[model samples]
Target: MFTFPILAVHKVIARGEADAAANGGFRNPWYGTRPRQGEKPGLWLVGDEGIYIISNGELAGGQKPLVFYSDECHPKGDTDWWDYKHRHFGGDDGIEFIDADLLVPSFDRNFGITHPGIRLTENDISFSLITR
Candidate 1:
């Protein structure tokens, strides 16, 4: 399991271009991207859709990373992770970024189960992926 930094978390109102107008003309980062396959490998942790490891070459066709999410969750929008920064991280305006990684134990995409060990505290968030 290789660890990658969680660049940003976008508040996904909806997927694809269907909700563009409501989302400021921006489609969810993973809108036109497909899951990682063959020699292509990219991964994203979606709040509503679990993890999506995209194909390597898919981004060249025009697709954004899944790091940008809706700005409605945290009080400061996309500037922070929930209220962790203000509530527990010393009450400063400092933003504490985290890292995310994807592990593909199997190539099966049929499992729709949500990871149950996702832990969110004032200072950290963690997740584990186990595809069946």
Candidate 2:
């Protein structure tokens, strides 16, 4: 197992609903950018620093957001913070918002980026992959 501390959580200022869904609703400043120094098929545990991602040992480069998470910037409205664990570093599974906090945050932050009209139950959500 390899561990990386995400000191920054960038905000995905979506142009619209479509854009947010494409990003798994959250941004990690360090996921695909830096070169992978660990083994492939590895488990990433995501918490305050335990967010786990299954790395494939590839560098897809980094992302630059308008604002980043710090003591200064925090979630607004009903928006709250949540962590995502990708089954595959960057895969299609990355789109779905799987965690418990998905519905409320997605609705508040992105205005129903996870699912619009449909009310999502816990079973409806699944693990997401980190998008590029």
Predicted structure with the largest TM-score when compared to the true one: 1
Please give me the total number of clashing residue pairs in predicted model 1. 12
Instruction: List residue ranges in candidate 2 displaced over 4 A.
Output: 1-38, 49-56, 63-132
- TM-scores, in order shown? 0.24, 0.17
RMSD of each: 12.0, 14.3
Which candidate number has the best lDDT? 1
lDDT per residue as tens, model 2, 1-132: 111222121112222122335443333324545443222222222223222222222232473223222221123321332322222222222222122233234444553232222222335523222211
TM-score of 1: 0.24
The global C-alpha lDDT for each of the candidates, from Candidate 1 onward, is 0.31, 0.27
Please give, for residues 1-132, the per-residue lDDT of candidate 1 as tens digits. Answer: 112222221122122222333333432233445332122232333333222222122232345534442223233444444343234333333322222113333212425533323334565656544332
**Cα-based lDDT at residue 107, candidate 2:** 42
What ranges in model 1 sit over 4 Å off?
1-40, 44-63, 67-81, 85-102, 106-112, 116-126, 129-132
